[model samples]
Target chain A: MPENKDYLNYIDRTAPKSPLLKNALLAFLIGGLICVIGQLIGDFYQKICGLETDSMRTAVSVTMVFLGALLTGLDLYPKIAKHAGAGTIVPITGFANAITSPAMEFKREGLVLGMSAKMFVVAGPVLVYGISSSVVVGIIYFLYKVLIGG
Target chain B: MATRLGNQTIALDKSVSIINTATVVGTKESEGPLSPFFDVKMKDAEWGEETWEKTESKMQKEAAKLAIQKSGKTADDIDCAFAGDLLNQCISSGFSARELGIPYYGLYGACSTMIESLSLGALAIDGGGMDTALAVASSHFCTAERQYRNPLEYGGQRPPTAQWTVTGAAAAVLENGGAGPYVTHVTSGKVVDFGVIDQNNMGGAMAPAAIDTLCAHFSDTGRSPESYDLILTGDLGRIGREIVINMMNSSGYNMNDNYGDSGCMIYDIEKQDVHAGGSGCGCIAVTACGYIFRQLKDGKLNNVLILGTGALLSPTSSLQGESVPGIAHAITLSNKPGGEG
Candidate 1:
């Protein structure tokens, strides 16, 4: 029987047709909306409370994280994530959802080992790489300053 | 009574029946569509275990015990237990065996362990090595994540293509000369690699192997998709399901109506956050034990083909940039007394 066929050829011929443009557009709009919400929160804190820019940024982030966690607990974020795709995942809200969702899932395990331990499952890599990369960049800057006598 | 139709297909000499089955799943799986069908839904994922790994062992033990109980047999009645899980050194199944107190055959077929164990158990009975045997497989999402992907504290962002590891265990008792769904035939699969290196998209990696096995089974048995009431793939999820369907169609067999995936059946993809669907040893194990076996027992389905697919890649292999190899094992079940189609 004719059992021999190029495997790569078969894969290309049979793969699902993805709606690349439409998906990208949805992701863009939803991601932009999340950013807009963050900006609005920042403005509210700055203008209404007379907070400094740095403080306002911090306040906005904290509020967004809280909102993300709350929505996740309510079982509402997944619905939005279904539609928004990467839009909901690219923002700070996604980070918040990452930590909150797993923590909520493992809560039945226990507080210390379950919730507190798994709380980093999604966010721990970000912290590790993020901090380590910054340190490396900081060292480079220090080297440049010392060498150039700036 | 026995026949080797082809290189991979084996027809059992004696009709081996799946006499009983049990499923135990975590809270997330309990919230899924097959929740009510499961034998035990743990109120807590931990089951009072100090760690997630131990919890997985407990789940496996409970599932095996429940199946043995349902079979109306004691642990001594089981000649041997064939089991495996997605944990280092197969600790979950090993620990489970310590509890079941049955002679054990620890297997590792990744997500395909469920069907692999079932096939082996059926073979053992047909070979007259045992009157009754137990087949069990398990996986826990937390433990699997920590072992296979990342630690609980890593807090990684899951790609849309990634699938949620099912937290559950399933056990089936295969007893010769019993009345239940009879295992008639099995098609052991060969490892096939299409050079897909992406770990996040396991379904893609395994789809080609599923296609290979399905095609081989059909050609070997001289049967088509219409011959079976249902043709189920273990954990192909949504993406791999499509790919396999397309591959099948191009290969001159259209399985559009009969084919489905256990991964896609476990949860509502739209309502639930599981991106690609459920994937793990437990995914197919629970689905078959909870849903498909019931249908078979009720005579809703007389003939069905279960193709258990697995991605055979370790974290080390993945990190070393090795391509994921995929394998599938197919078992045919019929409710008829003589294994009649």
Candidate 2:
């Protein structure tokens, strides 16, 4: 018998794993399925509402995102996320889920603590950046307008 | 760069023993402090916090007693406590530490609390700061389900990919001296954000974290895939485990050997009606404390690597449309012969 013995006798020594294809396919197929909802929204926003293409695009995107986020907060998104994988979350739905959950959770903390203060818990930084960048672009456009005498 | 444990010709085997371990959870407190969540959810019929605290606390105490009994050590001999729970403020662990009356160190690695606390406790012992340490973590079905997804009684259909959070907890006692395997190495997880944005089913979100950290562990240790006897993952369940294997295999590494997952073992999803599998610290901790630890004591496994993966997302964050990010922690356990007592 060997003087030095190995203590572990039944380690399930096997091979490395790969999970990308299944998940990727899940992402693609389910993700594509969710896009049908977006297409309908686009059509509704354009043909039904008769809104301008660019403005309608933004509005529909924002709405889809908001509803996606709201449903996510209500714990509906994970169910969709499970089947769709990346499909449901890749669109405006995931964004909406991310932005609103904080507000909903904090709503009870009081207006200042919950509603007003909670909106920024996770999404605050992104919101700040978006606003500041938009303002900067507006200022730059105005400066260029003055320079070009437009 | 196989950093063999002291093969310098003069190093004797280190036999590390487990002395004591304990756990605490919010599910047991009845009505002491955590009535707010239940009070609010009562209106929605998805109330969960009511029974969550009691369950968590019961799990903690039971696991602690089991660990202490297994190690042949008493609670007073425990020098420090390492604990984590799926709670906002780690109430499960905090309350346990307060009740058990030991110096405590609270840690969070999401579902990775098992490995996280073990790694910390092992370090505390290995660094010569303490003799015995306990690591524990827990999650309650009612509280976690309600907070993360819907109300307890909401009765919504879960997607096939979603996993069940096991109402679970586990405890492991780490001693400075004894027999068997010791904590040899650890690898911290890297945030593997593939820009995939889905926060609902956190198992899917965290599969990447498991792969990233497991692969990173292999890389950091400079060891090949065949080095360890066991490589375990926490709470990714069937879907997450499949994805992890797929991702790793695609990367020129196959994880078919010595690989089992915590989420897969905790419960029979068919019998239990769990859609996917089990998640939470208890998933890993309980499995290790029970079956896995027995195997170690029985000499079925020599070395093992346990990786606990956690998706770093809160209920509010997921609801806000933010992409879920995740983390994993890896702890290595190896056995050796008895030392000079």
Q: Tens digit of lDDT per residue, candidate 1, span B1-341?
A: 56897889998878799999999999989999989889899888688987788899999999999999999999999999999998889999999899888999999999999999999999889888799999999999888986777444322346666899999999999999888689999999999888877788888889988999998999888889999999999999988998898779988998899999999999888788788899999999999989999999998988999999999999899989888899999999999744554
Candidate 2 lDDT, B157-224, residue by residue in tens:
35566676766567888886666556667676766554435554556668778887777666655565
TM per candidate: 0.79, 0.62
Could you say which candidate leads in lDDT?
A: 1
How big is the positional error of residue A111 in model 1, measured in Å on the Cα after superposition? 14
DockQ of 1: 0.12
TM-score of 2: 0.62
Q: Tell me how far the alpha carbon of residue A104 in candidate 1 is from the true structure, in angstroms, after superposition.
A: 12
- Index of the highest-DockQ prediction: 1
Tens digits of lDDT, candidate 1, A5-71: 4755654454444466766788899889989999998889999999999999889999999988888
DockQ of each: 0.12, 0.03
Residue A78 local lDDT, model 1: 70
TM-score of chain A of each: 0.89, 0.62
Which CAPRI quality tier does the interface of model 2 achieve?
Answer: incorrect
